[model samples]
Target: MTNVLVLGANGKIAKLATAQLLANPDNHLTLFLRNSKRLANAASDRVKVVEGDAASEADLKAVMADADIVYANLAGSIEAEAKAVVAAMDASGLKRLIWISTLGIYDEVPGNFGKWNHQMLDGGYLETYGAAAKTIEDSDLDYTIIRPAWLSNNDEVAYETTQKGEAFKGTEVSRKSIAALVAKLVADPSQAIHESLGVNKPNTDGDKPAWY
Candidate 1:
Protein backbone atom coordinates (compact mmCIF):
# COMPACT_ATOMS: atom_id res chain seq x y z
CA MET A 1 0.00 0.00 0.00
CA THR A 2 1.16 3.56 -0.77
CA ASN A 3 1.72 5.60 2.36
CA VAL A 4 0.46 9.21 2.21
CA LEU A 5 1.29 12.13 4.44
CA VAL A 6 -1.32 14.89 4.53
CA LEU A 7 0.04 18.22 5.76
CA GLY A 8 -2.38 20.76 7.27
CA ALA A 9 -4.33 17.80 8.57
CA ASN A 10 -6.51 19.71 11.02
CA GLY A 11 -8.11 22.05 8.54
CA LYS A 12 -11.70 21.70 7.30
CA ILE A 13 -10.82 20.64 3.77
CA ALA A 14 -8.27 18.24 5.15
CA LYS A 15 -10.96 16.67 7.32
CA LEU A 16 -13.11 15.89 4.29
CA ALA A 17 -10.13 14.62 2.35
CA THR A 18 -9.09 12.49 5.31
CA ALA A 19 -12.52 10.84 5.46
CA GLN A 20 -12.36 10.05 1.77
CA LEU A 21 -8.85 8.70 2.09
CA LEU A 22 -9.90 6.48 4.98
CA ALA A 23 -12.65 4.95 2.86
CA ASN A 24 -10.15 3.79 0.29
CA PRO A 25 -8.52 0.37 0.85
CA ASP A 26 -5.33 0.54 -1.18
CA ASN A 27 -3.74 3.46 0.69
CA HIS A 28 -2.73 4.34 4.22
CA LEU A 29 -2.71 8.01 5.30
CA THR A 30 -0.94 9.89 8.04
CA LEU A 31 -2.33 13.20 9.23
CA PHE A 32 0.52 15.59 10.13
CA LEU A 33 -0.76 18.52 12.14
CA ARG A 34 0.52 21.22 14.44
CA ASN A 35 -2.31 20.67 16.89
CA SER A 36 -4.03 17.33 17.46
CA LYS A 37 -6.87 18.72 19.60
CA ARG A 38 -8.75 20.23 16.67
CA LEU A 39 -8.60 16.86 14.95
CA ALA A 40 -10.34 14.86 17.67
CA ASN A 41 -12.82 12.84 15.59
CA ALA A 42 -10.53 12.51 12.56
CA ALA A 43 -9.15 9.14 13.47
CA SER A 44 -9.62 5.46 12.68
CA ASP A 45 -7.63 2.23 12.89
CA ARG A 46 -6.23 2.92 9.42
CA VAL A 47 -5.51 6.62 9.97
CA LYS A 48 -2.38 7.80 11.82
CA VAL A 49 -1.74 11.25 13.26
CA VAL A 50 1.59 13.02 13.77
CA GLU A 51 1.98 16.30 15.61
CA GLY A 52 4.40 19.05 14.46
CA ASP A 53 4.76 22.26 12.52
CA ALA A 54 5.18 21.84 8.78
CA ALA A 55 7.91 24.48 8.77
CA SER A 56 10.23 22.52 11.02
CA GLU A 57 12.68 20.23 9.32
CA ALA A 58 12.79 17.72 12.16
CA ASP A 59 9.03 17.34 12.30
CA LEU A 60 8.80 17.08 8.54
CA LYS A 61 11.58 14.50 8.49
CA ALA A 62 9.79 12.39 11.07
CA VAL A 63 6.63 12.33 8.98
CA MET A 64 8.20 12.29 5.54
CA ALA A 65 10.16 9.17 6.19
CA ASP A 66 8.64 6.29 4.20
CA ALA A 67 5.88 8.58 2.84
CA ASP A 68 5.10 8.01 -0.82
CA ILE A 69 3.01 11.15 -1.42
CA VAL A 70 2.43 14.53 0.28
CA TYR A 71 -0.87 16.46 0.21
CA ALA A 72 -0.40 20.09 1.23
CA ASN A 73 -3.88 21.40 2.06
CA LEU A 74 -2.92 24.33 4.21
CA ALA A 75 -3.73 27.91 5.20
CA GLY A 76 -1.88 30.71 7.02
CA SER A 77 1.79 31.38 6.18
CA ILE A 78 1.59 28.49 3.70
CA GLU A 79 4.27 29.87 1.43
CA ALA A 80 7.10 29.66 3.95
CA GLU A 81 5.79 26.33 5.19
CA ALA A 82 5.77 25.09 1.60
CA LYS A 83 9.45 25.94 1.26
CA ALA A 84 10.18 23.96 4.37
CA VAL A 85 8.08 21.05 3.11
CA VAL A 86 10.00 21.01 -0.19
CA ALA A 87 13.30 20.98 1.64
CA ALA A 88 12.21 18.11 3.86
CA MET A 89 10.77 16.21 0.92
CA ASP A 90 14.06 16.58 -0.89
CA ALA A 91 15.99 15.41 2.15
CA SER A 92 13.77 12.34 2.50
CA GLY A 93 13.90 11.56 -1.24
CA LEU A 94 10.08 11.87 -1.51
CA LYS A 95 8.93 13.30 -4.82
CA ARG A 96 5.17 13.75 -5.26
CA LEU A 97 3.45 16.89 -3.88
CA ILE A 98 -0.17 18.00 -4.22
CA TRP A 99 -0.89 21.59 -3.18
CA ILE A 100 -4.34 23.19 -2.79
CA SER A 101 -3.95 26.77 -3.89
CA THR A 102 -6.42 29.63 -4.38
CA LEU A 103 -7.80 31.23 -7.48
CA GLY A 104 -6.07 34.20 -9.16
CA ILE A 105 -2.61 32.65 -8.86
CA TYR A 106 -2.33 33.48 -12.56
CA ASP A 107 -4.44 36.63 -12.34
CA GLU A 108 -7.29 34.77 -14.07
CA VAL A 109 -9.95 36.98 -12.55
CA PRO A 110 -9.76 40.66 -13.39
CA GLY A 111 -11.24 43.97 -12.20
CA ASN A 112 -12.70 44.22 -8.68
CA PHE A 113 -13.12 40.50 -8.12
CA GLY A 114 -9.48 39.67 -8.69
CA LYS A 115 -8.37 42.91 -7.10
CA TRP A 116 -10.45 42.24 -4.00
CA ASN A 117 -9.15 38.70 -3.67
CA HIS A 118 -5.56 39.83 -4.17
CA GLN A 119 -5.98 42.76 -1.82
CA MET A 120 -7.53 40.60 0.89
CA LEU A 121 -4.63 38.14 0.62
CA ASP A 122 -2.13 41.07 0.30
CA GLY A 123 0.54 41.46 -2.36
CA GLY A 124 3.19 39.82 -0.19
CA TYR A 125 0.94 36.80 0.28
CA LEU A 126 0.40 36.62 -3.47
CA GLU A 127 4.13 36.68 -4.10
CA THR A 128 4.65 34.02 -1.49
CA TYR A 129 2.04 31.69 -3.01
CA GLY A 130 3.45 32.32 -6.45
CA ALA A 131 7.00 31.71 -5.31
CA ALA A 132 5.97 28.52 -3.52
CA ALA A 133 4.13 27.29 -6.61
CA LYS A 134 7.09 28.12 -8.79
CA THR A 135 9.41 26.25 -6.47
CA ILE A 136 7.40 23.04 -6.94
CA GLU A 137 7.01 23.67 -10.65
CA ASP A 138 10.74 24.00 -11.11
CA SER A 139 11.59 21.10 -8.81
CA ASP A 140 12.57 17.73 -10.27
CA LEU A 141 9.72 15.86 -8.58
CA ASP A 142 6.19 15.44 -9.94
CA TYR A 143 3.65 18.02 -8.71
CA THR A 144 -0.04 19.01 -8.97
CA ILE A 145 -1.52 22.33 -7.86
CA ILE A 146 -5.32 22.84 -7.53
CA ARG A 147 -6.89 26.29 -7.18
CA PRO A 148 -10.54 26.47 -6.26
CA ALA A 149 -12.92 29.40 -6.55
CA TRP A 150 -14.38 31.13 -3.45
CA LEU A 151 -14.69 28.20 -1.04
CA SER A 152 -18.09 27.44 0.53
CA ASN A 153 -19.41 25.15 3.28
CA ASN A 154 -21.80 23.20 1.07
CA ASP A 155 -21.79 19.40 1.35
CA GLU A 156 -21.69 18.34 -2.29
CA VAL A 157 -19.27 17.22 -4.99
CA ALA A 158 -19.38 18.55 -8.54
CA TYR A 159 -17.20 17.63 -11.50
CA GLU A 160 -16.58 21.22 -12.52
CA THR A 161 -13.05 21.94 -13.64
CA THR A 162 -11.51 24.88 -15.43
CA GLN A 163 -8.43 25.10 -17.62
CA LYS A 164 -5.40 27.09 -16.62
CA GLY A 165 -5.39 30.75 -17.71
CA GLU A 166 -9.24 30.83 -17.76
CA ALA A 167 -11.10 33.08 -15.36
CA PHE A 168 -12.75 31.36 -12.38
CA LYS A 169 -16.44 31.62 -13.34
CA GLY A 170 -18.45 30.68 -10.30
CA THR A 171 -18.88 33.21 -7.54
CA GLU A 172 -18.45 30.39 -5.02
CA VAL A 173 -17.52 26.71 -4.79
CA SER A 174 -17.89 24.29 -1.89
CA ARG A 175 -14.89 23.58 0.33
CA LYS A 176 -15.99 19.95 0.46
CA SER A 177 -16.01 19.86 -3.33
CA ILE A 178 -12.47 21.13 -3.31
CA ALA A 179 -11.54 18.53 -0.72
CA ALA A 180 -13.15 15.80 -2.79
CA LEU A 181 -11.10 16.95 -5.76
CA VAL A 182 -7.97 16.82 -3.63
CA ALA A 183 -8.82 13.25 -2.70
CA LYS A 184 -9.17 12.45 -6.40
CA LEU A 185 -5.76 13.96 -7.11
CA VAL A 186 -4.22 11.86 -4.39
CA ALA A 187 -5.75 8.72 -5.91
CA ASP A 188 -4.84 9.53 -9.53
CA PRO A 189 -1.69 11.60 -9.91
CA SER A 190 -1.44 11.74 -13.69
CA GLN A 191 -4.66 13.71 -14.50
CA ALA A 192 -3.30 17.22 -13.98
CA ILE A 193 0.42 16.95 -13.40
CA HIS A 194 2.43 20.20 -13.44
CA GLU A 195 -0.72 22.30 -13.97
CA SER A 196 -3.03 24.42 -11.82
CA LEU A 197 -6.77 24.92 -12.43
CA GLY A 198 -9.95 26.38 -10.92
CA VAL A 199 -12.98 24.33 -9.80
CA ASN A 200 -16.68 25.23 -9.48
CA LYS A 201 -20.15 23.86 -10.10
CA PRO A 202 -21.16 23.57 -13.75
CA ASN A 203 -24.57 25.20 -13.55
CA THR A 204 -24.85 28.63 -15.13
CA ASP A 205 -26.44 29.98 -11.99
CA GLY A 206 -23.65 31.07 -9.67
CA ASP A 207 -24.12 28.69 -6.77
CA LYS A 208 -21.79 26.34 -4.94
CA PRO A 209 -22.84 22.68 -4.97
CA ALA A 210 -23.20 20.71 -1.78
CA TRP A 211 -20.72 17.86 -1.23
CA TYR A 212 -22.36 14.45 -0.80
Candidate 2:
Protein backbone atom coordinates (compact mmCIF):
# COMPACT_ATOMS: atom_id res chain seq x y z
CA MET A 1 0.00 0.00 0.00
CA THR A 2 1.24 3.50 -0.80
CA ASN A 3 1.14 5.66 2.31
CA VAL A 4 0.37 9.24 1.27
CA LEU A 5 0.84 12.22 3.56
CA VAL A 6 -1.02 15.43 2.68
CA LEU A 7 -0.14 18.68 4.41
CA GLY A 8 -2.71 21.49 4.37
CA ALA A 9 -5.29 18.81 3.86
CA ASN A 10 -8.13 21.28 4.37
CA GLY A 11 -7.13 23.25 1.29
CA LYS A 12 -9.31 22.99 -1.79
CA ILE A 13 -6.74 21.29 -3.98
CA ALA A 14 -5.54 19.09 -1.19
CA LYS A 15 -9.08 17.90 -0.43
CA LEU A 16 -9.57 17.04 -4.07
CA ALA A 17 -6.28 15.20 -4.21
CA THR A 18 -7.18 13.30 -1.03
CA ALA A 19 -10.40 12.10 -2.61
CA GLN A 20 -8.47 10.98 -5.66
CA LEU A 21 -6.07 8.98 -3.53
CA LEU A 22 -8.94 7.47 -1.57
CA ALA A 23 -10.40 6.22 -4.81
CA ASN A 24 -7.66 3.63 -4.71
CA PRO A 25 -8.50 1.31 -1.85
CA ASP A 26 -4.93 0.27 -1.31
CA ASN A 27 -3.80 3.81 -0.58
CA HIS A 28 -3.72 4.92 3.06
CA LEU A 29 -3.77 8.64 3.75
CA THR A 30 -2.39 10.72 6.60
CA LEU A 31 -3.91 14.20 6.41
CA PHE A 32 -2.48 17.09 8.41
CA LEU A 33 -4.26 20.41 8.70
CA ARG A 34 -4.14 23.27 11.14
CA ASN A 35 -7.67 22.40 12.20
CA SER A 36 -8.20 18.68 12.13
CA LYS A 37 -11.89 19.13 12.89
CA ARG A 38 -12.42 20.49 9.41
CA LEU A 39 -11.78 17.01 8.06
CA ALA A 40 -13.48 15.00 10.76
CA ASN A 41 -16.28 14.11 8.37
CA ALA A 42 -13.76 12.40 6.13
CA ALA A 43 -12.29 10.19 8.84
CA SER A 44 -12.38 6.53 8.01
CA ASP A 45 -10.39 3.37 8.48
CA ARG A 46 -8.07 4.40 5.66
CA VAL A 47 -7.76 8.04 6.66
CA LYS A 48 -5.82 9.47 9.62
CA VAL A 49 -6.32 13.11 10.53
CA VAL A 50 -3.80 15.15 12.48
CA GLU A 51 -3.99 18.77 13.52
CA GLY A 52 -0.75 20.74 13.41
CA ASP A 53 1.16 23.50 11.69
CA ALA A 54 3.09 22.35 8.64
CA ALA A 55 5.76 24.93 9.32
CA SER A 56 6.63 23.25 12.61
CA GLU A 57 9.37 20.64 12.31
CA ALA A 58 8.04 18.58 15.17
CA ASP A 59 4.57 18.52 13.66
CA LEU A 60 5.90 17.67 10.22
CA LYS A 61 8.20 14.95 11.50
CA ALA A 62 5.39 13.35 13.45
CA VAL A 63 3.30 13.09 10.28
CA MET A 64 6.12 12.01 7.96
CA ALA A 65 6.62 8.63 9.52
CA ASP A 66 6.02 5.78 7.05
CA ALA A 67 4.80 8.12 4.37
CA ASP A 68 5.86 7.09 0.87
CA ILE A 69 4.79 10.31 -0.82
CA VAL A 70 4.23 13.73 0.75
CA TYR A 71 2.10 16.33 -0.99
CA ALA A 72 2.23 19.79 0.54
CA ASN A 73 -0.50 22.24 -0.48
CA LEU A 74 0.42 25.15 1.73
CA ALA A 75 0.99 28.89 1.47
CA GLY A 76 2.26 31.86 3.53
CA SER A 77 5.88 32.26 4.51
CA ILE A 78 6.36 29.55 1.92
CA GLU A 79 10.14 29.73 1.99
CA ALA A 80 10.40 28.96 5.66
CA GLU A 81 7.69 26.36 5.44
CA ALA A 82 9.47 24.66 2.55
CA LYS A 83 12.70 24.68 4.48
CA ALA A 84 11.09 22.96 7.45
CA VAL A 85 9.41 20.40 5.23
CA VAL A 86 12.61 19.60 3.38
CA ALA A 87 14.49 19.17 6.63
CA ALA A 88 11.85 16.87 8.08
CA MET A 89 11.66 14.84 4.88
CA ASP A 90 15.42 14.37 4.91
CA ALA A 91 15.37 13.28 8.52
CA SER A 92 12.55 10.85 7.86
CA GLY A 93 14.38 9.43 4.82
CA LEU A 94 11.36 10.23 2.66
CA LYS A 95 12.13 11.34 -0.90
CA ARG A 96 9.01 11.96 -2.96
CA LEU A 97 7.52 15.43 -2.61
CA ILE A 98 4.91 17.32 -4.58
CA TRP A 99 4.97 21.00 -3.67
CA ILE A 100 2.68 23.72 -5.01
CA SER A 101 3.89 27.15 -5.97
CA THR A 102 2.53 29.79 -8.33
CA LEU A 103 3.19 30.71 -11.93
CA GLY A 104 5.57 33.54 -12.90
CA ILE A 105 7.72 33.11 -9.82
CA TYR A 106 10.72 32.65 -12.09
CA ASP A 107 9.46 35.11 -14.70
CA GLU A 108 8.40 32.04 -16.62
CA VAL A 109 5.49 33.89 -18.17
CA PRO A 110 6.37 35.95 -21.21
CA GLY A 111 5.43 39.41 -22.48
CA ASN A 112 2.40 41.23 -21.07
CA PHE A 113 1.34 38.19 -19.10
CA GLY A 114 4.59 38.27 -17.22
CA LYS A 115 4.38 42.00 -16.68
CA TRP A 116 0.85 41.83 -15.34
CA ASN A 117 1.66 38.96 -13.04
CA HIS A 118 4.57 40.83 -11.49
CA GLN A 119 2.50 44.01 -11.14
CA MET A 120 -0.13 42.04 -9.27
CA LEU A 121 2.12 39.96 -7.04
CA ASP A 122 5.56 41.63 -6.98
CA GLY A 123 5.67 42.32 -3.23
CA GLY A 124 6.14 39.88 -0.38
CA TYR A 125 4.04 37.18 -2.06
CA LEU A 126 6.40 36.95 -4.99
CA GLU A 127 9.52 37.01 -2.87
CA THR A 128 8.35 34.22 -0.58
CA TYR A 129 7.14 32.07 -3.46
CA GLY A 130 10.37 32.43 -5.34
CA ALA A 131 12.32 31.61 -2.23
CA ALA A 132 10.16 28.54 -1.66
CA ALA A 133 10.79 27.26 -5.16
CA LYS A 134 14.51 27.83 -4.80
CA THR A 135 14.49 25.97 -1.50
CA ILE A 136 12.81 22.96 -3.06
CA GLU A 137 15.17 23.02 -6.05
CA ASP A 138 18.24 23.10 -3.86
CA SER A 139 17.10 20.26 -1.65
CA ASP A 140 18.47 16.77 -2.28
CA LEU A 141 15.04 15.18 -1.97
CA ASP A 142 13.28 14.07 -5.15
CA TYR A 143 10.69 16.76 -5.75
CA THR A 144 8.20 17.92 -8.36
CA ILE A 145 7.35 21.57 -7.91
CA ILE A 146 4.01 22.49 -9.48
CA ARG A 147 3.59 26.13 -10.43
CA PRO A 148 -0.07 26.52 -11.32
CA ALA A 149 -1.52 29.39 -13.28
CA TRP A 150 -4.34 31.52 -11.86
CA LEU A 151 -6.58 28.94 -10.28
CA SER A 152 -10.24 28.62 -11.25
CA ASN A 153 -13.09 26.75 -9.57
CA ASN A 154 -13.99 25.04 -12.81
CA ASP A 155 -14.39 21.29 -12.48
CA GLU A 156 -12.58 20.36 -15.67
CA VAL A 157 -9.50 18.15 -15.44
CA ALA A 158 -7.92 19.20 -18.73
CA TYR A 159 -4.57 20.93 -18.45
CA GLU A 160 -1.00 20.92 -19.75
CA THR A 161 2.45 21.36 -18.22
CA THR A 162 5.54 23.33 -19.21
CA GLN A 163 8.90 22.26 -17.86
CA LYS A 164 11.11 24.60 -15.89
CA GLY A 165 12.67 27.29 -18.15
CA GLU A 166 9.82 26.85 -20.67
CA ALA A 167 7.36 29.68 -21.14
CA PHE A 168 4.33 29.19 -18.88
CA LYS A 169 1.30 28.67 -21.11
CA GLY A 170 -2.30 29.82 -20.84
CA THR A 171 -3.75 32.21 -18.26
CA GLU A 172 -5.74 30.01 -15.88
CA VAL A 173 -6.49 26.41 -15.01
CA SER A 174 -9.10 24.57 -12.96
CA ARG A 175 -8.40 23.59 -9.37
CA LYS A 176 -9.55 20.12 -10.25
CA SER A 177 -6.91 19.93 -12.93
CA ILE A 178 -4.22 20.77 -10.44
CA ALA A 179 -5.55 18.16 -8.04
CA ALA A 180 -5.58 15.58 -10.79
CA LEU A 181 -1.96 16.32 -11.57
CA VAL A 182 -1.04 15.94 -7.91
CA ALA A 183 -2.86 12.65 -7.70
CA LYS A 184 -1.15 11.44 -10.87
CA LEU A 185 2.23 12.34 -9.44
CA VAL A 186 1.44 10.52 -6.22
CA ALA A 187 0.57 7.41 -8.22
CA ASP A 188 4.01 7.53 -9.81
CA PRO A 189 6.35 9.79 -7.90
CA SER A 190 9.14 9.34 -10.45
CA GLN A 191 7.28 10.99 -13.33
CA ALA A 192 8.40 14.57 -12.65
CA ILE A 193 11.14 14.09 -10.09
CA HIS A 194 13.64 16.94 -9.96
CA GLU A 195 11.41 18.94 -12.29
CA SER A 196 9.32 22.06 -11.84
CA LEU A 197 6.22 22.38 -14.01
CA GLY A 198 3.74 25.11 -14.85
CA VAL A 199 0.19 23.85 -15.29
CA ASN A 200 -2.52 25.66 -17.22
CA LYS A 201 -5.66 24.99 -19.18
CA PRO A 202 -5.41 24.16 -22.88
CA ASN A 203 -6.69 26.91 -25.23
CA THR A 204 -7.21 29.32 -22.32
CA ASP A 205 -4.38 31.61 -23.33
CA GLY A 206 -4.92 35.36 -23.21
CA ASP A 207 -3.13 38.42 -21.91
CA LYS A 208 -4.57 37.65 -18.50
CA PRO A 209 -6.51 34.91 -16.81
CA ALA A 210 -10.07 34.55 -18.08
CA TRP A 211 -11.42 35.48 -14.67
CA TYR A 212 -10.02 39.00 -15.03
Candidate 3:
Protein backbone atom coordinates (compact mmCIF):
# COMPACT_ATOMS: atom_id res chain seq x y z
CA MET A 1 0.00 0.00 0.00
CA THR A 2 1.28 3.48 -0.87
CA ASN A 3 1.03 6.01 1.95
CA VAL A 4 0.26 9.42 0.41
CA LEU A 5 0.54 12.72 2.23
CA VAL A 6 -1.49 15.57 0.75
CA LEU A 7 -0.70 19.14 1.74
CA GLY A 8 -3.27 21.87 1.09
CA ALA A 9 -5.85 19.15 1.19
CA ASN A 10 -8.72 21.62 0.97
CA GLY A 11 -7.62 22.93 -2.40
CA LYS A 12 -9.83 22.11 -5.39
CA ILE A 13 -7.18 20.12 -7.19
CA ALA A 14 -6.13 18.35 -4.01
CA LYS A 15 -9.71 17.40 -3.22
CA LEU A 16 -10.14 15.94 -6.70
CA ALA A 17 -6.81 14.11 -6.44
CA THR A 18 -7.80 12.74 -3.06
CA ALA A 19 -10.94 11.29 -4.56
CA GLN A 20 -8.93 9.80 -7.39
CA LEU A 21 -6.48 8.22 -4.94
CA LEU A 22 -9.27 6.92 -2.75
CA ALA A 23 -10.75 5.12 -5.75
CA ASN A 24 -7.93 2.64 -5.32
CA PRO A 25 -8.46 0.87 -2.04
CA ASP A 26 -4.78 0.11 -1.72
CA ASN A 27 -3.80 3.74 -1.30
CA HIS A 28 -3.89 5.32 2.17
CA LEU A 29 -4.10 9.09 2.55
CA THR A 30 -3.14 11.62 5.21
CA LEU A 31 -4.51 15.11 4.64
CA PHE A 32 -2.93 18.28 6.05
CA LEU A 33 -4.58 21.67 5.91
CA ARG A 34 -5.00 24.85 7.95
CA ASN A 35 -8.70 24.20 8.44
CA SER A 36 -9.83 20.60 8.67
CA LYS A 37 -13.38 21.71 9.41
CA ARG A 38 -13.99 22.42 5.75
CA LEU A 39 -13.53 18.74 4.89
CA ALA A 40 -14.75 17.12 8.04
CA ASN A 41 -16.53 14.48 5.98
CA ALA A 42 -13.28 13.38 4.34
CA ALA A 43 -12.16 11.37 7.35
CA SER A 44 -12.56 7.66 6.79
CA ASP A 45 -11.18 4.26 7.64
CA ARG A 46 -8.15 4.80 5.37
CA VAL A 47 -7.88 8.55 5.71
CA LYS A 48 -6.54 10.78 8.49
CA VAL A 49 -7.08 14.53 8.64
CA VAL A 50 -4.52 16.77 10.30
CA GLU A 51 -5.06 20.51 10.68
CA GLY A 52 -1.97 22.75 10.61
CA ASP A 53 -0.03 25.23 8.53
CA ALA A 54 2.24 23.79 5.84
CA ALA A 55 4.84 26.41 6.75
CA SER A 56 5.19 24.88 10.18
CA GLU A 57 7.89 22.21 10.32
CA ALA A 58 6.36 20.75 13.47
CA ASP A 59 3.01 20.31 11.75
CA LEU A 60 4.55 18.83 8.63
CA LYS A 61 6.95 16.55 10.54
CA ALA A 62 4.14 15.21 12.64
CA VAL A 63 2.22 14.08 9.55
CA MET A 64 5.22 13.20 7.40
CA ALA A 65 5.86 10.12 9.44
CA ASP A 66 5.58 6.91 7.36
CA ALA A 67 4.38 8.82 4.30
CA ASP A 68 5.58 7.38 1.00
CA ILE A 69 4.96 10.42 -1.18
CA VAL A 70 4.16 14.14 -0.77
CA TYR A 71 1.85 16.12 -3.02
CA ALA A 72 1.48 19.80 -2.24
CA ASN A 73 -1.33 21.90 -3.77
CA LEU A 74 -0.71 25.39 -2.50
CA ALA A 75 -1.02 29.06 -3.40
CA GLY A 76 -0.09 32.51 -1.95
CA SER A 77 3.45 32.70 -0.57
CA ILE A 78 4.54 29.41 -2.09
CA GLU A 79 8.22 30.19 -1.69
CA ALA A 80 8.02 30.08 2.07
CA GLU A 81 5.75 27.04 2.04
CA ALA A 82 8.06 25.25 -0.38
CA LYS A 83 10.98 25.82 1.95
CA ALA A 84 9.06 24.41 4.88
CA VAL A 85 8.02 21.34 2.92
CA VAL A 86 11.57 20.68 1.74
CA ALA A 87 12.91 20.94 5.26
CA ALA A 88 10.26 18.62 6.64
CA MET A 89 10.76 16.07 3.86
CA ASP A 90 14.51 16.12 4.42
CA ALA A 91 13.99 15.66 8.12
CA SER A 92 11.81 12.62 7.46
CA GLY A 93 14.13 11.24 4.75
CA LEU A 94 11.31 11.34 2.19
CA LYS A 95 12.42 12.10 -1.35
CA ARG A 96 9.40 12.03 -3.63
CA LEU A 97 7.40 15.25 -4.00
CA ILE A 98 4.85 16.69 -6.41
CA TRP A 99 4.36 20.46 -6.18
CA ILE A 100 1.75 22.53 -8.03
CA SER A 101 2.98 25.83 -9.37
CA THR A 102 1.48 28.01 -12.13
CA LEU A 103 2.40 28.68 -15.75
CA GLY A 104 4.55 31.71 -16.68
CA ILE A 105 6.55 31.36 -13.48
CA TYR A 106 9.55 30.76 -15.73
CA ASP A 107 8.33 32.93 -18.61
CA GLU A 108 7.72 29.73 -20.54
CA VAL A 109 4.83 31.20 -22.49
CA PRO A 110 6.06 32.73 -25.75
CA GLY A 111 5.39 36.02 -27.52
CA ASN A 112 2.08 37.78 -26.82
CA PHE A 113 0.92 35.02 -24.52
CA GLY A 114 3.88 35.57 -22.26
CA LYS A 115 3.53 39.33 -22.32
CA TRP A 116 -0.16 39.22 -21.46
CA ASN A 117 0.45 36.84 -18.60
CA HIS A 118 3.04 39.11 -17.04
CA GLN A 119 0.89 42.16 -17.55
CA MET A 120 -2.13 40.51 -16.00
CA LEU A 121 -0.26 39.28 -12.94
CA ASP A 122 1.90 42.44 -12.65
CA GLY A 123 5.07 40.44 -11.71
CA GLY A 124 4.46 39.76 -8.03
CA TYR A 125 2.71 36.43 -8.60
CA LEU A 126 5.48 35.20 -10.84
CA GLU A 127 8.09 36.29 -8.31
CA THR A 128 6.68 34.11 -5.56
CA TYR A 129 5.89 31.21 -7.89
CA GLY A 130 9.35 31.30 -9.39
CA ALA A 131 10.92 31.40 -5.96
CA ALA A 132 8.97 28.32 -4.96
CA ALA A 133 10.08 26.48 -8.08
CA LYS A 134 13.67 27.46 -7.40
CA THR A 135 13.48 26.09 -3.88
CA ILE A 136 12.27 22.67 -5.09
CA GLU A 137 14.91 22.62 -7.80
CA ASP A 138 17.67 23.38 -5.31
CA SER A 139 16.52 20.75 -2.87
CA ASP A 140 17.92 17.22 -2.69
CA LEU A 141 14.49 15.66 -3.01
CA ASP A 142 13.19 13.83 -6.07
CA TYR A 143 10.50 16.22 -7.27
CA THR A 144 8.21 17.12 -10.14
CA ILE A 145 7.15 20.77 -10.22
CA ILE A 146 3.89 21.12 -12.16
CA ARG A 147 3.15 24.44 -13.82
CA PRO A 148 -0.43 24.33 -15.06
CA ALA A 149 -1.97 26.77 -17.48
CA TRP A 150 -5.14 28.73 -16.68
CA LEU A 151 -7.40 26.21 -15.04
CA SER A 152 -11.00 25.45 -15.94
CA ASN A 153 -13.66 23.34 -14.26
CA ASN A 154 -14.37 21.51 -17.51
CA ASP A 155 -14.43 18.06 -15.99
CA GLU A 156 -12.25 16.62 -18.70
CA VAL A 157 -8.77 15.05 -18.63
CA ALA A 158 -7.39 16.11 -22.00
CA TYR A 159 -4.01 17.73 -21.59
CA GLU A 160 -0.36 17.73 -22.72
CA THR A 161 2.94 18.60 -21.12
CA THR A 162 6.04 20.65 -21.97
CA GLN A 163 9.37 19.93 -20.36
CA LYS A 164 11.23 22.69 -18.58
CA GLY A 165 12.88 25.20 -20.95
CA GLU A 166 10.28 24.46 -23.63
CA ALA A 167 7.70 27.08 -24.53
CA PHE A 168 4.47 26.51 -22.63
CA LYS A 169 1.59 25.78 -24.96
CA GLY A 170 -2.17 26.40 -24.83
CA THR A 171 -3.97 28.76 -22.45
CA GLU A 172 -6.29 26.52 -20.45
CA VAL A 173 -6.66 23.12 -18.86
CA SER A 174 -9.35 21.46 -16.81
CA ARG A 175 -8.89 21.00 -13.10
CA LYS A 176 -9.71 17.32 -13.64
CA SER A 177 -6.77 17.00 -15.98
CA ILE A 178 -4.44 18.38 -13.35
CA ALA A 179 -5.84 16.03 -10.76
CA ALA A 180 -5.45 13.07 -13.11
CA LEU A 181 -1.81 13.91 -13.66
CA VAL A 182 -1.17 14.24 -9.94
CA ALA A 183 -2.81 10.90 -9.27
CA LYS A 184 -0.70 9.27 -11.96
CA LEU A 185 2.52 10.72 -10.55
CA VAL A 186 1.65 9.80 -6.97
CA ALA A 187 1.10 6.23 -8.06
CA ASP A 188 4.53 6.16 -9.76
CA PRO A 189 6.67 8.83 -8.15
CA SER A 190 9.76 8.25 -10.30
CA GLN A 191 8.10 9.06 -13.62
CA ALA A 192 9.13 12.72 -13.70
CA ILE A 193 11.65 13.11 -10.90
CA HIS A 194 13.66 16.33 -10.83
CA GLU A 195 11.71 17.79 -13.75
CA SER A 196 9.42 20.80 -14.11
CA LEU A 197 6.51 20.48 -16.51
CA GLY A 198 3.94 22.81 -18.03
CA VAL A 199 0.50 21.28 -18.48
CA ASN A 200 -2.32 22.51 -20.71
CA LYS A 201 -5.09 21.24 -22.87
CA PRO A 202 -4.29 20.50 -26.50
CA ASN A 203 -5.84 22.90 -29.06
CA THR A 204 -6.77 25.47 -26.41
CA ASP A 205 -4.11 27.99 -27.34
CA GLY A 206 -5.10 31.63 -27.04
CA ASP A 207 -3.60 35.00 -26.22
CA LYS A 208 -5.04 34.75 -22.73
CA PRO A 209 -6.96 32.25 -20.68
CA ALA A 210 -10.24 31.47 -22.45
CA TRP A 211 -12.28 32.51 -19.48
CA TYR A 212 -10.80 36.00 -19.48
Give all TM-scores, in the order shown. Answer: 0.88, 0.98, 0.98
Badly placed stretches (over 4 Å) of model 2 are: none
Name model 1 segments beyond 4 Å from true. Answer: 204-212
What is the total number of backbone clashes in candidate 3? 0
* Alpha carbon deviation, residue 59, candidate 3 (Å): 0.9
**What lDDT score is found at residue 140 in candidate 3?**
97
Of 1 and 3, which scores higher on TM-score? 3
Report model 1's TM-score to 2 decimal places: 0.88
**Candidate 1 — number of clashing residue pairs?**
6
- lDDT, residue 190, model 3: 72
* Global local distance difference test of model 3: 0.92
lDDT of 2 by residue, 1-212 (tens): 99999998999999988988899888999999989989998888999999999889889999898899999999876888999999999999999999999998888899888889999999889889999989999999899999999999997899999999899999899899999999898778779999999999999878888778
In model 1, which range of ten residues has the least summed lDDT? 203-212
Please write out the lDDT profile of model 3 over residues 1-212, one tens digit for every residue: 99999999999999999999999898999999999998889899899998999988888999998899999998766888999999999999999999999998887899788899899875588889899999999999999999999889997899999999999999999999999999999777779999999999999887888778
